[model samples]
Target: MSQMTLEKRFGQSTVFVASTLMENGGVPESATPESLLKEAIHVISCGYEDKTDWGNEIGWIYGSVTEDILTGFKMHARGWRSIYCMPKRPAFKGSAPINLSDRLNQVLRWALGSVEILLSRHCPIWYGYSGRLKWLERFAYINTTIYPITAIPLLAYCTLPAVCLLTGKFIIPQISNIASIWFISLFLSIFATGILEMRWSGVGIDEWWRNEQFWVIGGVSAHLFAVFQGLLKVLAGIDTNFTVTSKASDEDGDFTELYMFKWTTLLIPPTTLLIINLVGVVAGISYAINSGYQSWGPLFGKLFFAFWVIIHLYPFLKGLMGRQNRTPTIVVVWAVLLASIFSLLWVRVDPFTTKVTGPDVTQCGINC
Candidate 1:
């Protein structure tokens, strides 16, 4: 169930009208639920009798998970300023999804909702009320709303390294090159900053690492699917139904009954990526050995990324193979399709021509 609380500061000004208000002639017979909601806010902001407080009139409406944030965005776009509060002592607490499938569905719903708002006329960037928003606020809203779109670029980044490894194609600069140093430095800087931010947010190192693991898992499974679903809804006029997260059960410890086959589709991308990376790692090691360890540095880089993918995907792999966790047949089909596409890319790139020429021994006689 959805819940909300009006802050003490806004309590007196905010009016909560009942059906009785209509009988008393306070609200019109023709007033709709939407109109009544608007009127309540208006009356509160405008005040009744001698009291008129126009500028400070702000309203908040809570909808289902799929609509709540959208409602907030629409309201903000109508020249209203709102702050999202996360009190030190939580004002409200709710159960979250305890399993992977339910968690993914929750994330997908959020991503789809944000995409819907971003595509709508109420989009903060181009909407009429956009001018009323501060520049910083506008940027922040835009960033938040367009989060789903990042999945596309993220997908490419995640897959491209594995693809390169499979095809014996190197995108990273040579170890001896200045660009390599810069690239390594930049990656470490971003990683370190992420750790610092996580620490600042009161997360421990283990928790932060676990969060990153889930970040990869959720990005591939939920985020990518949501982006595609959102685009299909917007472009093809397809309707995407929302799935409510499963509530925690106190009486029964087992919640597996709440799990559905629909979630099995999400396993495809991560599973396929894992398989490809595993194959790439094996092939990379073989090629490095065959080349008399001439390309150990580049092979090591490829294997490192492949290992990263494997680490994040270990749980998914286990689930796929587990008899108790038996995945849907459709997941197998999707995995095969993904593998075929990868194989085509590998063949097209022609891994045979990718011989690594060891560095000139004379360039560093003693060091060599």
Candidate 2:
């Protein structure tokens, strides 16, 4: 029954996209339930395998698994964040979702899983001071720290930049402000992804890890992997083939009409970002003498950029070279995609071409 609801939502999105394709030819955002789940999950999990504690939800896992089995914190922080980006917002929003519903459900679920950890058996830890006295406290502290990552400059990003430049303010140097925000966003996003991957992998990405005897049986991010696979199944059923997002595995630029530009850029390879990364290893040695500043940073930056660019490149090239075998590959696919994009293209299509959308294209615009 639960799965059916999920499927229905997924199907709803597919129908919406397919209808859009049939109607407008194809707008990029088909927002079916599967893709929504994947996006939400990815945004939440990313490189999740690298965090500690899993935050506060450990207690909710309750007596199901002893303390010895658990590592770090209890809550699946990334998973929690990922939940926010789901198809429909939760009924009561963040407060109710986390504090009440998630808490009760996860605790019961964990208990029901009947999984145990070696750590639970060895230590008086789960029942001791750390277990009862400070579960939420630990999570609160971690959550508080992450707040600065997003909270500090949000007002500035949304409004202050224009205001500051107009007022000629220099208190928080514009360059410093932008750099800080961008770096913080990138670093935190990556860290969040890594941590989510680790903590929720068992439940979200792959279920094999849940066997408790699997190679990664103690996997923290098992939740996300399992969930992601389920979402993938949802996506597969949705007929989102015309939707171009990112490459599944091998990193490369590809037709990324599906997702937003910011994410696609992250997938783009640094080498292609500029020749600097591609040739920097050798170039830095030579340039270091002339520039005085360490060429290493520039070189590294380029290489890093290339890595991102390469991932995006596959799709970009595939689409550009006309080599893309977007299955059901009759000319109809391209025609539909172009038409869909036109219906939805509010801005320039970029390096692809100037397939612009007009105010006239907006169906819901006030012009009506």
lDDT of 1 by residue, 1-368 (tens): 11122323233322333332333324445567887677577555634322222223334333324566655555565555665567899988877766667777788888777787777766767865534666777787788778778777767777766777777777464467687778899999999999789877878888877787777877887888888887788899887888677767666566654443345467778878876777777777888888886799777777777787788777667656655556777777788788778868776867557567776888878787
lDDT of 2 by residue, 1-368 (tens): 35344333323233333443353343345466776676556434534222322222322344323232233333332122112234455555322222211222243233212222212331223333433335564444334222222312332232222222122222243367779989899999986775686676434434432332221111212222223333343445421121221222334334233222221211112112222222323433455556666645544443343344333333333333343443233334443454334323422322223456655637767765
For all candidates, the clash counts are 0, 88
- State, as a TM-score between 0 and 1, how close model 1 is to the true structure: 0.70
* Top candidate, metric lDDT: 1
* Candidate 2 off by > 4 Å: 1-182, 203-276, 291-368
Query: Cα deviation of 220 in candidate 1 (Å)?
Result: 1.9
The residue pairs that clash in candidate 1, if any, are none
Which lDDT value does model 2 have at 207?
49
Cα lDDT computed for each candidate against the true fold: 0.68, 0.33
